[model samples]
Target: MSTTTKTNHIGRKISRIRELRGMKQETLAEVMGISQQSISHIENSETLEAEKLGKVAKALGVTKEGIENFSEENVINYFNNFNDNSFSNSQGTFNANNCTFNPLEKLMEVVEENKKLYERLLKAEQEKNIYLEKLLGK
Candidate 1:
């Protein structure tokens, strides 16, 4: 497939991951440290950069390899099918309660929440530095 096709495939995969995790565009952007507008752009299949790809992979709890290798047709078909399901009373709306796999979404939350731990670590280091400085009369 062409590069355009690959990019579109990745974009649709992102949308699925977001919907699976029940994350809004704004929330995903916050987790990825990018603007929601950027997420919007990427999901719409406009264009994507390596850095944005990394951020999306991190926030979506998917590996770069997985994201890169995802099938465009499957991703797009899923979105199209999902939309169709929403309108079809027989298929109904999206729900994982009936599915077999543990949702990938939890990973997204856990990884993003690690930021809090990082902050705590930084504070502890700062406090340790202060104590050491006082000990040395600096």
Candidate 2:
């Protein structure tokens, strides 16, 4: 006979991923149209309803499976792999058949572009909040 151990704590996983992504409970609550206390309750539970989990996953900018399968060790491994020097040459370029490839440079360019996109998204969210506050003032 085999005993199955339930090791996946969905709520804690959600909280950890949220913190890793630099998101606060208040921000997640605003996106989910819930209260901060509600977010707190969700984070303390071992399991979540499928619908609410989906909502939380969406608000956190990750898929439900991502939250379910997240492991801190895996994230650390990914960072270590990313920082490995073997991926780059001494000149920071890849040499292949008389062609020099600098994929790291290209990756950095995309990362910069993504940063700009996130900044725009944050600005838009702030503007929307300001507009909502004005509506509340009326």
How well does candidate 2 score on lDDT at residue 118?
Answer: 100
What lDDT tens digits, residue by residue, belong to model 2 across residues 72-98?
A: 887886566553333342356443345
TM-score of each: 0.43, 0.57
All models, RMSD in angstroms: 14.6, 16.0
Stretches of candidate 2 above 4 Å error? 1-6, 84-138
Pairs with steric clashes in candidate 2: none
Top candidate on lDDT is 2
Cα lDDT of model 1 by residue, 8-126, tens digit = 46687778778877999999989877799988889888446787788788888888776776665656676666643252224665543455655678777788789889999999999
Flag regions of model 1 displaced more than 4 Å.
1-8, 71-138
> Native-vs-model 1 lDDT?
0.75
For model 2, what is the alpha-carbon lDDT of residue 85? 38
Backbone clashes, each candidate: 0, 0
What are the lDDT scores of the predictions, listed in order? 0.75, 0.86
